[model samples]
Target: MEDDKHSLGLRVIHWLMAIFIIGMLCSGLYMKSLPLSNEIKFNIYAIHKACGITILGLIIVRIFFRVFTYVPPLPANFSRFVINISKAVHFGLYSLMVLMPLSGYVMSSASGKQIKYFFHIPLLINQNKDLANTANELHSMLAYFIVLFIILHMLGALKHTFIGKQNIFKRMI
Candidate 1:
């Protein structure tokens, strides 16, 4: 049935966010390991900040669309346990998606660093070392949780598609 599949717009946004989030996670880790004085590291940092800001904007758009859209329900055959776990994982993913970038922006802002949109337009904020340190810690903590949630989400979909014969992956595709 048509209702089983996510809307085309939702699917597109879902895939786009997936790609961007994965890239951000990878680059963020790589950026951290590199020496601060490295030119490549600075370039990566700029790209990371720009992408984080872009992701924040996309999250706003996603919330707006989610409000007006009909989200397809999980397959009926799944156990209540599975359903509840799925809901929790979805919630975790959404929460992390919003929080990660927000904390990044807050950290940057509190550190007196102006985050330029796409490495050009300046978005300014006041500086506070205390808040910057706090936000930075929170942002760092979130990275691990987001990775866990993403893995759970993917494994669930794969299990449903291949083991359970639910074809759940097709809903988003």
Candidate 2:
């Protein structure tokens, strides 16, 4: 059986994650591009860290929701190859959604930077520069892949809506 749209919980999580991830990406790019003072940059980094932590929590909840919820099947006309590709894209997105925040948290914690939830809760761990550098490199590398996958995902949705007239985008709405 298939439904025309996603559940309310799924839609809520999707939009919330989209907003948070976009904000984190824009802030990260801007922070890297300018010659900002160390203090200012540090402040921005703190905000990013807080957002990342929140995203991490959301992703955890999303995982549970995904396991418990029923996902609609693709249109019957969709070929096996198309279904496989769709699965791959969804898997990639979910993987990055979890990894991106996790890698950031590791980088921050290992680099001796404090990671607090809204500047109130303490989330400190033992410092390890080597681990920090590794996590940072992984996070940096994955960012490009994430962006690429996101664009591809969006294009697929647009194609379904405009070219195929499949109404696939409505499933997520």
Residue 120 error for model 1, in Å?
6.4
Please list all clashing residue pairs in model 2, or write none if there are none.
none
> What would you estimate as the lDDT of candidate 2?
0.84
User: 28 in model 1: Cα distance from truth in Å?
Assistant: 0.4
Per-residue CA lDDT of model 1 for 48-117, tens digit only, reads: 9899988888888887777788888887888999999998998899899999998998898888776777
Cα lDDT tens digits, model 2, 49-106, are 8898898899898888878887677889888988898889989999998999889988
Candidate 2 similarity to native, TM-score: 0.92
Separate clash counts for every candidate: 0, 0
Per-model TM-score on C-alpha atoms: 0.93, 0.92
The candidate maximizing lDDT is 1
**Cα displacement (Å) at residue 127, model 1:** 1.3
* Candidate 1 displacement at residue 141 in angstroms: 0.9
